[model samples]
Target: MRNLHKIKLLYEKYLNRTATHEEVEELFMLLRDRNQFQHIHNIMEDEWERNDIDFSVENLSWEKVRSEWPTEQKISDVREMPIEKHAIWSLKIRKIVAVAAGVLIAGMMLWWWTKTNTKEYRTGFGETMEIVLSDGSRVLLNANSKMTWNTNWQNIQERTVQLEGEAFFEVSHQRMPVNNSSPDQKDSISLMPFQVITSDLSVNVLGTSFNVASRRQKTDVFLKSGEVLLVAKPPLPRSKNDEKKTAGPSLAKHMDSIYLTPGDHITYSGITRALERHEEKLPDEPTSWVDGFLVYENEKLETVLQELKDIYGKSFIMEDSTMLSRQVDLGLPYEDWYTVSELMSLSLEIEMEENNSEITVKKLEK
Candidate 1:
């Protein structure tokens, strides 16, 4: 390891204007260490304060730099000087201030780019929203989930979306235009990569239909048709003893990929980042919600009611708690909101009484 003390001495010598060129190079080499960045920043601040540069002028100068940095267009405010010679800034102080301004400008741009480039799709309780993408693909976002994607998606070949809830995706196919310059040219449209990124797994596909559900630190991907490739990214949702800090650049460290044919289901644990795959007999009923029908197959009466609560933003309380557990199978349409509960009650052969926010269900015979 390079001695840090040597770096400090070299910086001091440079500040005193007595350092050799070789010493200056060594000092910069030491500054390349990220750990040294903050140390150097502290030294720069000290030097700025020691030089007694006018506070008002320095602030005005930085404001000018910040506004013009993105355009690379020069402005006169920072470079303007007072008539008095003593008020002029030293070359070393000017250099330090320029570097500081550049660093500040870089940080500001990074933050602005991150905020502006992405757009979010979110649905409230029981709301299912259909979003048409710029690439002609469609996404059916489920209740109480958020999905974020690049707003400038058309310019990028690879399409990726980050998800926090359930969504159904119908990826669009891209066809390359014919090239007439060469008569012998063949069609060469590269398979566009589409990824639905959850906290743990990245579901990659070309042109396919798939469902992703992420809830309670668990991510599930079900392939309804075509194929998918799942890559696991680690430092998953925190767990006891295995927890790592979640705030940092999320660079994908794909250990391996699991390939899935049609009707394959994969679940990834947010804590362990362990993946488990299984073959599923894909059913149309699972995605019937996208077409405005919510189907329940032998699910609990309580579960069915809760799903209703999500869709309609209503409160459901079973007077007979055990009846709530009774297996109920039915398909509820999104239309006829006023009559839905009555229709569901008659269909299930049960008595349902609604009092404002609450829905009560009980045995008809009783």
Candidate 2:
């Protein structure tokens, strides 16, 4: 019974967002211990079903509890329970059950609160979304992207998020007011960097706008405005047994980062461990898709064809590899497939024909 009271206190602390990290971790560990919490969870579920409480809003936060308590009191006023003297034989059993029920209710409240309060946003294929955060920072999520953060953003020491796929952020410059408990008295707003972590690299910035492409196979970063730092993962250490078998002298240290100025793009290839940077020239067109345009300049014919297939669902076949290698410098508007094909043909001096909806390009023999 004493242990049950301690658990209830910890749960209340968690709901109030006042629990330490260690305490939160301990609470989750206890919840996941099926042998300990399974019976409690089942009992709580039944109790919740019988009560006419609105579980959806109640599960999201403790703020609703204060608002709903008054209404619940009004409802309870109409019901009356008969008082009975406790029988000696069943008194101990009743006390034990009451304590167990209290513990169970607290556990269920904590579980539901955690599950519903966490903020998560995701975009599906060919879908884009814009998010305005509580801090006034704006995020533009590209196709097939996901972003998530904790709900206790106002109380947390730092604002952070986990992101996948691609996004462009315009972060607000206003610094959040720090609590008195914070150890650092000096304002470290610049030092507190925002991070976009991919599978192989992490991009850190204080306040900047940049594009991040972090698909499984390819990871890329393009800095449009302000400064950003890139950190690549260190190579894994070889095992003792395999060290002798592999006879490649000592491995050279890989270049983890190459800082980018505005209009600079860096691509990190995991298979090659090579970090390549290309200067952004005229027709800066990589992120044009966000603006509803496909602008390609001096792009290879094959590369442009692949882009067309991805966006317009149009496949192509090149009879001659040499012809396909011809680089074309053109900007095809992203309105329709026919317009794009006409623009490409006009720029490249080629004949484009659609046979069963598959585009075929042929160089004019002249």
Candidate 3:
């Protein structure tokens, strides 16, 4: 309320030709703020009514101005130019100012609304988070991960989200009306595809539970239950014509796509841009990490150490190069990091010394 009063005072001073140069600039800066749209509109409407400006015929409201506003233009560039005192009371001048103010506010509103609607979720190293999206879907974000999505899902055709690092998704089913259907089939509703996009691949699913990890220039997807489709994105085009051709469905259709069933795992290397599939039986409960436990069997020692580093924010150093070839079969709880370290040392038959966040491994003397 106080801000509205101040804006009205500055506007009145501007019209009376009593405002200094700095005051005129301050009034414009305040008017450019999107949050003050309603206040500015109210002030302008009151001014127009007093000046006997006919708005009824034109149906000029803030919404109409906003819809017709140019998006690419900046409102800050619209400054109040100095005019003669004789021109201050001109009815034509008053109407021009009113229209210009509405357009300026609309431009700022478009940019500000977009920024406020997109949401981001992130986790720090050694931290994990569980997010319940607006669509009733659930995401278990692992350590050092980020996910972004548009919160306005009702207006979106596709349920899409971008992921970086690792996360487990349990997507909810959404039945939306099929578009471009025949008149008789207009009432038909179909399952909407939920997409999790990474740098190199897009995982499309219709209500499924799976884990996705994209890090170190590689992407790994492990299906826990339900179906998933992996679509490899096309490489960047070298020319404008190539870019246009790739934008067509023909190019995207030719891109590699693989289907996954439960217990299936696929690894995509960003360097080679090739996918390698593994069909062996996964160790007991591959997603046990989501329950605060790291469970793996016959996994390389180096892989286990890397998982440890991600969870505990620790660095592992192997004094003996042969340790890299060792395999680990273990299930350790997240809360018991020290005990897990001790158990790993005993199982590997190596001397493990920890100093701060670095762990040094040496061959134990027999």
For TM-score, the strongest prediction is 3
The lDDT-based order of candidates, best leading, equals 3, 1, 2
| Comparing 1 and 3 on lDDT, the stronger one | 3
lDDT of 3 by residue, 144-251 (tens): 889997676666567888899889999999889887559988888898789999887888999899999888777889998898877777532234433422233433
Error of model 1, residue 191, in angstroms: 1.8
User: What's the CA RMSD for each of the models?
Assistant: 14.7, 14.4, 10.5
Model 3, 199: alpha-carbon shift in Å?
A: 1.6
Clashing pairs in 1: 126-310, 126-311
lDDT of 2: 0.62
- The digit string of per-residue lDDT tens for model 2 on 14-131 reads 5445889998666665554333454444444444444432243225444543443335554454233233422432343333343344455556756765565567888765557889
lDDT of 1 by residue, 1-366 (tens): 355667657766776668898986676566544445456556655655666633332355566545434332322433454545323433534545555553553345446555776789999865788899887889999887899987655554568899988899999986545445665665544666788988777888889998888875778887889988776665433333222212233355634456666776767885776666554333665567778887777677776776566557678666677887688778788664566777787888888777886766677884
Show where candidate 2 strays beyond 4 Å. Answer: 1-127, 144-155, 158-164, 177-192, 235-258, 309-315, 336-338, 349-366
**Of the candidates numbered 2 and 3, which has the greater lDDT value?**
3
Weakest ten-residue segment in model 3 by summed lDDT: 72-81
Winner on TM-score (1 vs 2): 1
Candidate 2 clashing pairs? none
Per-candidate TM vs. native? 0.58, 0.55, 0.64
- Clashing pairs in model 3, backbone N/Cα/C closer than 3 A: none
Q: Is candidate 1 or candidate 2 better by lDDT?
A: 1
